[model samples]
Target chain A: MIDWFQKLGRSSLALFERLGRGGLFLMRVFAAIPSLVPRPRLVIIQLYSVGVLSMMLIVISGLNVGMVLGLQGYNTLVDFGAEESLGQVVALSLVRELGPVVAALLFAGRAGSALTAEIGLMKATEQLSGMEMMAVDPMKRVIVPRFIAAIISMPLLAAMFSAMGILGGYFVGVGLLGVDSGAFWSQMQGKVDFYEDIMNGLVKSVVFGFVAAWIAVFEGYDAVPTTEGVSRATTRTVVHTAFAVLGLDFILTALMFGSV
Target chain B: MIQKRTQEIAVGVFVAVGLAALVMLAMKVSNLSSLSDQDGFEVIARFENIGGLKERAPVTVAGVRIGRVKTVIYDDKSYDALVTLSIAAKHNQLPEDTSASILTAGLLGEQYIALEPGGAETMLKSGGEIKLTQSAFILEQMVGQFLFNKAAEGTGESKAAEGAGP
Candidate 1:
């Protein structure tokens, strides 16, 4: 029993330590934001790698998600003789819920893990230390650009995902299932709102981007400078990012949609 | 150097498309594009019940949208639901006798206002109130009313038979 108590104490202490470190890391990143404006080249490179490179994965998953929605939504809507509202169902679900959440999850898995691994490797290789020795702040030169790029890219990725998903739904619903193309488009047009559905989704994506990216960068920076430590940090980045994005999505959705 | 330039261009394109999609979503999803940029005239309508109708719901005339619902209010003294509509300026020729009805898009879709034009020469200007209006038809209320009437009739018949017993 005494051993158990000691273990509990140790874990709590470690948790507190990590929390303090993370809070400081986040502040440092925020403080580095102004430096990005003067030298956008650093930020743009990360954007290309993180944002543009992930496009292929996002597009593929978006298409598949749409096709699945079309197949499932069509069958269910047919039961209620609401086959014409297939577009509305697909569009609303994608734009309001699935698009942002799934995109963030994908972003976390892809870009978030990569960010952690890359930074972790840099630390392990003494490159971050080398920058310090050269009197360059690694926070400004390394972490800030990636963080800003991530926030910029997330909503764009989400929009593209939703747009592609809608097209996939159309292909399946109209091309294969023979749902009325006109009604599909018209119903979607009539029901979906700009402020409520699209704007809220964009906001959710941005929030998720900030969170997921922060986790990735922080995990990398905080990891012990070793091979095993870097690998562990990468895995933790993805896991933690996924959880944060989903939990935050729930809270934001309620605030945006729940009669407020 | 060329690779970097290409990457920059690609990012720019991606951002541009994303912004366009956002605009499309805003306009199409909210159905804001249905209303033109032209200024519209605000008019008032009162109903005994607005049902599930919401503000920003489209106000259409003869199956064509002419405006949107600007506000919904409940009159304290009169105990009636008041709806404010903003009709398009170009379509400002709605007669004073024109009637307004709250309708659904489809059987189980969103509620909207449908205006039926009347054969009056005078046009309704801003702040004009549509006198003849129909409230939303709720299926639940109709079913409740029907069941209640049937039960009442059955009880009444039983009472009459007992009173007339020989």
Candidate 2:
């Protein structure tokens, strides 16, 4: 019993240590925000790498997901003799939930992992220490731009995903299934509420972007300067980002759609 | 300098695409396109029950949509749902005595208000109250009543006689 109690206490301490470190790192990022403002060029470059580079993955995933949704939604709606409502189902599912969630997941995998790997590699090369030796704050020069770029890009990527998803749904529903395009669009227009569906998804994506970027950069910056450590940090960035996105999604959905 | 210019162009394209996506999302989600009924006049309708009736539900006349539901308010005094509709100006020729009924698009699809014109000379002005309104069809209650009636019939005339046993 004593041995078991000792193990539990040690694990709990480690967990608290990680949480405290993460909180402090977040505070440092916040402190370094002004450094990013005067340097639009840095932010723009990071945005291109993080946001623009991730576009292809987001669009492809969104299209496939929406196509599948169209197929499945059409089948289900047909059973109720309401196949005309395929557009509403497709648009609702994408705008309210899947677009944000899928974009975040893809963003974590493509951009977040890349951020972690790049930063981790820099740390492994003693470049971060080199910057410190040169009297430069690596947090401002290195981390803040990437952080700000990521946060800005996410909602935009999510919107693109939603738009492409709608198009994919249209192709499947209207082209293949022969659903009346006019009815499909009109029905969707009538049913979907702007504030409730679209804005809610945007808000979710923004929160997710902040969390994912924070995890990616922090894990990278804090990684031990070793090959194994860099790889582990990259992996952890993806894993942690996925968990954070899903957890935040559930809470946001509850807050947005639930009777709160 | 050329490299910087190229990078700036790429960033410009990226920002432009992002803005396009934003506009598309906003238009689709909010119905903010040219087709949206921005300039519309208000009208009121009262119903005993507005089951599954939501704000922004279409108000159609003879299957052509002319307006959208603006709001749904419950009047405690009469226990009626007072639905306000914002109709496009082009559909301003509806008679004052026009009747409105809540109808489903498909059998189990969304519900909307269907207006039927009456043979009245005077047209309804903006903000006119549509006095004749039918409530939405409650499928569950209808099904329950149907089952009850079927069970009663299965038991024959004895159940009916028992109910009239005064």
Considering every candidate listed, which one attains the maximal TM-score?
1
TM for every model, in the order presented, reads 0.93, 0.89
| Number of clashes found in candidate 1 | 4
- Residue B40 alpha-carbon offset, candidate 2, angstroms: 3.3
Mark the 10 consecutive residues where model 2 chain A has the least summed lDDT. A189-198
Question: What's the DockQ of model 2?
Answer: 0.55
- Per residue, candidate 1 scores C-alpha lDDT tens digits across A202-253 of 8898899999889999999988899999999999998998888888988998
Give me the displacement of residue B9 in model 1, in angstroms. 2.8
User: How large is the i-RMS for each model, in angstroms?
Assistant: 1.5, 1.4
Candidate 2 residue-wise lDDT, B83-104, digit = tens: 9999999889999899999998
* Candidate 2 chain A TM-score vs. reference chain A: 0.98
Clashing residue pairs, backbone N/CA/C < 3 A, model 2:
none
